[model samples]
Target: MLKVYGRANSINVRKVLWMLDETGQSYSREDWGRGYRATGEPDFIKLSTFGVVPVIEDNGFVLRESHAIVRYLANKYGRTDLYPADLKARAVVESWMDWAQTDLYAAARPVFHAMIVNAADPATAVAPTDGVKSWAAQMLRLEQYLTGHGPFLAGDQFTVADIPAGLVVNRWFTLRFDKPSLPAITAYYDRLSERPAFRTHGRNGTP
Candidate 1:
């Protein structure tokens, strides 16, 4: 069985957990940086110098980073559907994965911090900023892409792109704010919501 280190509340950890669920990979997970897992533990630092959530050990090969772990697991298990075997096809899917970490997540960060972290009352907090502008613009871009792609981000097939994307889309919809809606993105969210794995971890209702 694979071993994963992270807490369930972590978004990055959720990505890995969701992937494992979708791939039907069995894993033992340890709560890190919360509950019982002590902070600055030497054992964890040895596995991941960055001290980030979602470090995986498959057999004896240790790996970190949610995106890398997802790709590694999908490839190692010969799940070519999730992680495409073709170079170009894989690149297209991976690009969205990167975009989630960089562009989409970046766009959502400040607002997330303001709403969830800095606010006095998380339930009613809505921090106004241009972050929503950038986020909505990017969502519009996503709408255009989905219009062409019809269903998935990279192509017709649901790939690894959807794993990372699922969490972000969940956040977008769950985040309480006033913004123009993207029907395509909403439709995509509904499609992803149908998957049992996604329902279990991706949008388990935590932002």
Candidate 2:
């Protein structure tokens, strides 16, 4: 059996759990982070030098990073729709995955950190409006992408690309405040909401 190490409420860990559920793979989860299974402990640090939640132990292989784990599972199971076999198609999906971690999260992190971790109100970007504008601007780009690019992120089919990016949608939509109206993104969000895995792990206000 596979072993997943992370807290249940962590958004990143939830990505792996959601993907596992989507793949119909059975795995055991461990409670880590916060007060439970502290990552700073020497034992856990051997698997993850960065001391982050969400480390996967499969057979004798140890891997960290949620997105990498998602891709590994999709490839291991030969789930072509999720990871794709065609070079170009896989590239397109991978592109979105990279973009989400790089551009999307970069913009959203400050707002989320301030709001959730710092317990500060962020109806707008509290200090500098740049973070809020940047995140919203990224969202507008997504709206444009989904305008023609959906029923899913990479295409009409649900893919691994949607796993990481969709979680961000949960964070954005679940956060209370006025947002620029994004019809296409809203519809795309509705599409994600229909997934059982997404509902259970991605969108239930944890992020």
Candidate 3:
């Protein structure tokens, strides 16, 4: 059985869980993150030197990083529909996944920390104005891509790429901040919401 180590509400961990659900893979999970077991513990550090959540042990193989785990599982289970076998198609999927982590996540994190985390402690709350502005700018890029691309990030089909992308987009919508109207992104969010796996893990309102 695959063993996943991470808290359920973690964005990274939720990516893995959503992928598992999409692939219909059964796995057991352990909570190890904020509000749960600390990843700094020696045991977890031994598994992931970076001491991050969303580590996975499959059979005798140990792996960390949420995106890598999702890709690995898709390949391992022969879910070609999610992770394409075609070189170009696979590259497209990988590109969007990478963009989600690098570009999209970069903008979303600060906003999330300010609006969600810091807001919970009023004394510590920093105005999310700047973060929201930057995030909105980044999202505008996404809106343009989706406008031309239509439906999914990697094109027409929903792929493994959408897991991380969807989660970040959900955060954009869920966070309490005034947002610019982005029609294409709104449609994309609606499309993602229709997916049962996404509903359970990506947009179930944990963000």
Q: Candidate 3, overall lDDT?
A: 0.89
Measured by TM-score, the strongest candidate is 3
lDDT of 3 by residue, 109-149 (tens): 98887766656774555547888888888899999998888
**Per-candidate TM-score against the hidden true structure:** 0.93, 0.93, 0.95
Residue-level lDDT tens digits of model 1 in 1-207: 899899987788999998898888788999997555864798889888888788888888989889999888898889998888899988888899999889888888888888886889999897566888887877787888887775887778788898887788888888889878688899999999889988888777888
Better of 1 and 3 by TM-score: 3
- Which residues of candidate 3, in runs, are more than 4 Å off? 120-127
Q: Once model 2 is optimally superposed onto the true structure by TM-score, how far is the C-alpha of residue 48 displaced, in angstroms? A: 1.6
* Model 3: per-residue Cα lDDT at residue 118: 57
lDDT of each: 0.85, 0.86, 0.89
| 2 versus 3: better lDDT goes to | 3
What is the Cα-based lDDT of residue 65 in candidate 2? 89
| Among all candidates shown, the one with the greatest lDDT | 3
